[model samples]
Target: MRPRYMLSGNISPPSSAMALYSTPRSDKRTLQRNRRWPGSSATRSSATSTLSRSGSMLSSCLQCRTSTCRRISISERVICLILHSRFSFSKYMSESHLSLRVCYRKIAVDEGGLPSWANSKYRKYTPGKPHPNAIEYLVAVDENFFAFNITWPQDDSKKYDDPEKKLDQMRAYVTYFVEYDKQQLPRSKQPYIFYIDSRWASLKLMELLHENQLFGVLSCGENMRPKVLWSWIKADLAKYDWWSIGLPRLSANLVCVRTKDKVYLKILTNYCALKEIQYKKRKRKFPMTEFYVAACDVQKEYNAFKCKVDQLNKAVLEYFRLSRYLDDKVTFTQFFIHLFTVQSWTYYNACTGRSLSQLEYRVLVLQELAVEILPPPQPSVLAVHWPKHMGGRTHNCQYSPCRNNCTYFCIACEKWGCLKCLEKAHLNG
Candidate 1:
């Protein structure tokens, strides 16, 4: 007996050579005119009349020949011929067979009149530079606070994990001011000094200073020993001729000013010696009381400078309010106002009762305020509309995965539809 094998359902062999050879040739005419435009109505009517005559002739020939070949109709032949001529077969059929046509007329506008597409009237505003005499200071402060939990023992494993990130944030905080200084300061003059809190007195910060070549001062907490800080100051002084030391006084902080001015330093330290020399030359006429009155006038001028800062802050806040968008969800205006106020307080603490000269105090106050009111953050997202085929992609589509084949959200129709569907349903009709 012959061996038998089980067969799977619907198992079939591939097509034979004769089957492949005998397959009908694809209509090359169909491929040629896939996207061709339909001819005018008069041309289409003429072609149709010719096709009818050909049909009659073809039918009579087929009846006489009695051939086994499949008959080709006149309508089909005329379609192939029309398509080969590169005229739109589909559009011709729609116009002649279906009886419909659409034509658009262009409109022209005279000079000085706006175009049809003109929409908005308001122009964009560009900001200008502030005055040179304007005082501005860039200030950076960092505070370390311990995290607590209800659990018995502390979770110290996460301590080092956050330091790098925190350091990056602090560095970014100072970078903004550095950019501002570069833009506003003249190339000839040295950059105004940057001020930071004591926690940043790390080797990491020093490395950053060396890398960026920045001139700045680091103010430590009151508990930092004076002798140790003095040693650090002397070492820093050797490298940089200009340095300022902030020390705790009876009620407030005192910043001892020093510079590379050898002549001025000697004159300040030995005023009596200078006076004695001046007496010998018979040039010491003015009493010391006159100098005291002059100093009091300088104090009055400093008070006027403080008033100007207050005025500037108020003006900046008002400008911020004007620029705020009506639909803004964030309280950015209020945030900026609070920021300016905090900056003013820091300036007051750094300068008030610190024996700062009138000119130095004014400069510091203005610099601090400038850094505070550095332009507001730009809008997070912008809306845009682009013409089809312009290579623009929609961001917020109704169909995210596009399983249902929606293209994008339509605000007008309140629905989502693919481009093909939209063209067929709305544009075609």
Candidate 2:
């Protein structure tokens, strides 16, 4: 079987694909778009996209002779993949096919900020001169920026950053996206969204941004704030598109309408189920205009997900309720009986791909009948996570194979949790 890797439309790392949710007060669910990480659509125009004169390193690797060793890139970030005659790893690895690391880096003097690599004259090229760790640089760097961390124990408290290298890392980051965009971006295009995940990273980038006079859309949540953050950065806020809701917040999927005041955060619409309890309890503080439209869009998405969940559950229940007769040994069409006698939904059935016995399968099927409705577990967006660095009371979230990957919990309605089922349970909920 061809190996499959998860990819997101934005510039984020592959494994960190987040299934974002709109807060209870807001009806919309969203996977906030990353402006720097343009989806597959952006790759069509390579001339204006990532690479400069060196062009894409991975694509350029096509000229590699069989069994030959060739280094790719015009910057410090480099990756080597072996190609063999029998298998088409080459076919599988293409610009269209998303890899989790930086496939290409730029080598422009204006974009390059760091001291030269050995091949600085002929070094690996990366996206603009972003810090190799910049969200956009990481996207272009590899198909999996943190693949080692996917199976990383959620409970383990391992620190990845070294304090000494922080300034250097931050410099690389600003060079990647901010500097890269300044060079290749068309004058007509608005800046792409660069999500700031931590307070320190935000502080460092904002500081570098003012000094360099570069611009991009920066989105972040509440925990990212320090008391003096906005106070100092507010002056240069207009230099770029700084999209945020000052409240301690989660990333929303729907495109947010930008405003100067916090009143937009309080605004809700008639269509949202939350309108009655959250917004109507008090007098309206802000005038509702475009936000009224955004609220409606959120509701529309939520309702669609809600309807899909209800329909799937009803079908699964009905299928099991009526499948008994066909499951019998003496049935004419025993194929489906075998298919479901396995009890596809059960944890063991899915793992072993078999039931311990027919009687055991029957018991498992009956268990499904007892539930009036089974709401699958929901996984929260990876962006709005309860950090792995901080230990929590809930070890493994209410999802998965005891991998200790449970890091998310919903205190809003006491519904849905952790990473495993975030998309199914949380989105539908």
Using TM-score as the measure, the top candidate is: 2
Candidate 1 lDDT, 171-275, residue by residue in tens: 543343344334442331332223333333333443343334343333333233232443333332321122221111101111212222221110000000100
Cα-based lDDT for every prediction: 0.26, 0.28
lDDT digits (tens) for residues 150-184 of candidate 2: 01011111122322223343344444444444455
TM-score, cand. 2: 0.21
Question: Candidate 2 — which residues are off by over 4 angstroms?
Answer: 1-167, 177-193, 210-214, 217-225, 228-429
Backbone clashes, each candidate: 7, 44
lDDT of 1: 0.26
Q: In model 1, which runs have C-alpha deviations exceeding 4 angstroms?
A: 1-165, 181-188, 221-331, 337-429
Worst-scoring 10-residue span by lDDT in model 1: 266-275
